[model samples]
Target: MPSLDDQPAASDLHHAVLAWYDMHARDLPWRRPEASAWSVMVSEFMLQQTPVARVLPVHEAWLERWPTPADLAAEPTGEAVRAWGRLGYPRRALRLHAAAVAITEQHDGVVPDSYDDLIALPGVGDYTAAAIASFAYGRRHVVLDTNVRRVFARAVAGVEFPATAVTRAERDLATGLLPDEEATAATWAVAVMELGALVCTASSPRCGACPIADVCRWRLAGHPAYDGPPRKAQAWAGTDRQCRGRLMAVLRESEGPVHASALAAAWDDAVQRERCLVGLIDDALVVRVGPESYALP
Candidate 1:
């Protein structure tokens, strides 16, 4: 038999986290029992590298416009980019559109049930596929998203953050924590994720209120500062990302194809502006209509 030192008791950890979630979980629309698989898939796409509050309004508007994958797919991919509206990383919008088309043509507008099928969709990576499979289908897959990984890093592994990239060791630890029952494992996945998102945040963690605080290895170890490679803050202003955002804003608000000069008016730097516009066109966020004009794709 393995010694207690080998791992935390899964039963106790699940009980604490799930009991906490029962009281404290956020009532996100995608989490509603009635929420369809398509809704959950869309939420996962919008939530990538974006905050919940920012994603909420956009998500609601998007669903209202395109109620199903087929509805979104039936529209031009450019329409998806237009509706995306300042969500940042407009590339996600493009990929989501591609996924919707794939879902409509391949899966009969139903989001795939198996991890393999979900991942096969464009822009649907490991985490997204696992999430759709677990949350939508109530499967017992190991869903190691950012929030879940952070929770595991501190509470289980006694670390300030997970590795810069997911390691094999991390996957094994996550798999080990999977609840035996499929439904319980699904709940455990989202509950742990919620705990990290709301309580054990990157900075200013409210550990005192965390239900699993008593058992958190990082707390028991005195919450040492991260000693790994420094985490870099993403720069927005004056970067290509910001430049792209400005260019996109012009395109999003325009009625007809925007002239090169019209797009140029959004940014002062002619060179950077041109680069961003070309980048947007390459990403399929914009379609060049004429020699000197562009529109949403």
Candidate 2:
């Protein structure tokens, strides 16, 4: 097994993966030089647990309507939720709206460049803060998303998957592998993430196409299967999430508030429908305007 302490091997891995990225990186609008910091921030929010193809059109429409943080902030929160358009997690829209309001009010309508400032925004966590700073501002920071984590698990630790939650050890490994120069480190972070997304995918990793296949510990170790605690499976049908989506879809399509009967027609289970409606209200994704009438908020 190659040691993590081996600087020469680490450098080789970096160079090989980065060279591969240079050749194959997707020309995402958010990654382009012309993309604003707001554009990158929006992409990050929309991309969470959502596929790129699904997010692309919505992202384009969103930017077209509200080109800046101030523009989004000027609109009603309900407008934000309506614009979200079946992204699954509606709360992300609320949080994104809140973050936009913050950026407009606190940062003069500009996405903050500093990690601390970015992290201070609503819904911005460690990984997000680091990613926005590095990817948007070209700042050097350790940006470990799921793909990056899985790549590290297989290539460096010889594990099929990482722990369900990130550990201190994983953070340290990412930090250690970050390039010294700011620009190089920034590019390296996204490069590794791209490699993971394109080649080292979760279910069907293309190890044969990987740049560091020669040094991949998991491949060298015979591609052992993951034996960690069972990963959470996402259930859709009959779930509250689906119920919520159906109800939200009704509200989104309607120009005015929908009656309780309209919402009841969307989902058959009266109890689950009512429960999810209340939950959405509590989550501030929905608002009640009249007796038994609901609308996006």
Candidate 3:
């Protein structure tokens, strides 16, 4: 593990990253110069544990409907949940809606410019907060996501892979690598993340096209294979998560509230279906409209 104090100068790396990004960065909607802070924040939340390709259309449609925090805040939570579509984790939509409400009520209906204030919002974790603060507000923050972490681990620490999650050491190192100019550092953060996503992938990395391949410590260290345990694949069909999504989708598409029978018909397993509904209700993703009817909160 390389300490922050021992890391290489970030200027050269920053330039290299920016150069690569200028040529190869994808034209993501959130990264557009005209995109609002709320749009960037929404993209960050939706991109969590989900791919950019899958998030693109959903993000566009969402922005088209609710361009501002106030717009989303004015709508019912059910709309947000229903608009979430098959994004796997429906809870993110609920959290995002809550965050929008917080922004509307607390932050003058504008996404906060400070990292602390952004992170303080409901469901805004370190990654989302840093991303929004840096990408949207041009604040000097070390945007450390999974992709960024992997890039740093391989390039700086010479590790085959990153730890299970981000750590303090990782944050410190990332901070060290940030450029002197805040805007440039923010752009570099996104560029590095994009590089990891496009070229230095988890599976078969296209090292031939990598900009920092020459400086990659992992590659210079004989390109050793990752020795960790094989990643376990989670099943989607018949799972509680799937059942919960199905139930929420029905409620989201409904105008008022959905009947218990309508929700029950979504899943075949009665026990799993009921548990999913209860879990969603407990999580505040769904609310009881009547004695036996449920709708998204």
Candidate 4:
């Protein structure tokens, strides 16, 4: 439970971070100066739990189709879900569509400038909302995603990691690390997050290339090992999440509708397949076209 005082001063860390970012930042689409707020928002949503390589093409195609929240809201949910091909989390498609609709109706197709307003939209949780607000709107906020949290926990707290979920104390600590000026703070948050993604990765971190390595408390303490139990890996091949993804893929490929039997073909286990299909329909990721046909919604 180390505190900020026990680590390098905030100013030192900020300077190191900004300097490192300027020299080594990746050439990402969303990070471009010319990228629009809507494009940034779309990138943020797509990048969640997905890799940068997978998100690049999808983000480009998505923006090409619906440049604004109003443009997406104008289309059917099926089209949105269809465009979300193989992104792993299909529900995010529905939620992103819902958020677009909300933005179109409430904010006149514009991504909101305020953090509170952005958070009110569907699927825009603390991380997404803070990202949108800071990166897109240039507003000051503590953007604590898994990467940022881990970086800070190790660098400042000398702990191997933060909690599985962010806590209020983490939020407060993140906010404190922010610069006094709004613009600087926004840049710092992005830089730190990028640093974590590239250098301080979850496994086999590149400490040699880390910008703040010289002053990081964790490094000073000899990079002590994480003593916690190993995290359990979620099953993918024969799980409900896999079944849901397969069913959505079928609907995505089909223009009009797909037979329920067709979806059952995705899995061999009849009980599990049936259960997954029903869950998708119940979750509004898919809709029953008729008694036996289903389509993405």
lDDT of the candidates, in the order given? 0.89, 0.91, 0.86, 0.86
Write the residue-wise lDDT of candidate 1 on 42-119 in tens digits. Answer: 999998899999999999999899989999998987788888887878889988999999998989889999999999
Off by over 4 Å in 3: 1-9, 235-237, 253-256
Name the candidate that leads on lDDT. Answer: 2
List runs of model 1 lying over 4 Å from the truth. Answer: 1-6
After best superposition, candidate 3 residue 121: deviation in angstroms?
0.2
The sequence of per-residue lDDT tens digits that candidate 4 reaches over residues 1-297 is 444357678998999999998898898888899899999999988988999999999999998899888999999887888899988787788888999999899888888988899889898898999999999988889898888998998898777777777778888888789999999989998999999999999888899998788777877788888876677798878778877777778888888888877887867788988898889888888888798988777
Winner by TM-score between candidate 3 and candidate 1? 1
In angstroms, give how far residue 294 of model 3 lies from its true place.
Answer: 2.8
Alpha-carbon RMSD to native, per candidate: 2.2, 1.8, 3.0, 2.3
Which scores greater on lDDT, model 1 or model 4? 1
Better of 1 and 3 by lDDT: 1
- Model 2, 113-190: lDDT tens digits are 999999999889988899999999999999999999999999888889999999999999988989999999999999
- Cα-based TM-score, every candidate: 0.95, 0.96, 0.91, 0.95
Clashing pairs in 2: none
Name the runs in model 4 displaced over 4 angstroms.
Answer: 1-5
Supply candidate 2's per-residue lDDT for 278: 92
lDDT score at residue 249, model 4, on the 0-100 scale: 80
Rank by TM-score (best first): 2, 1, 4, 3
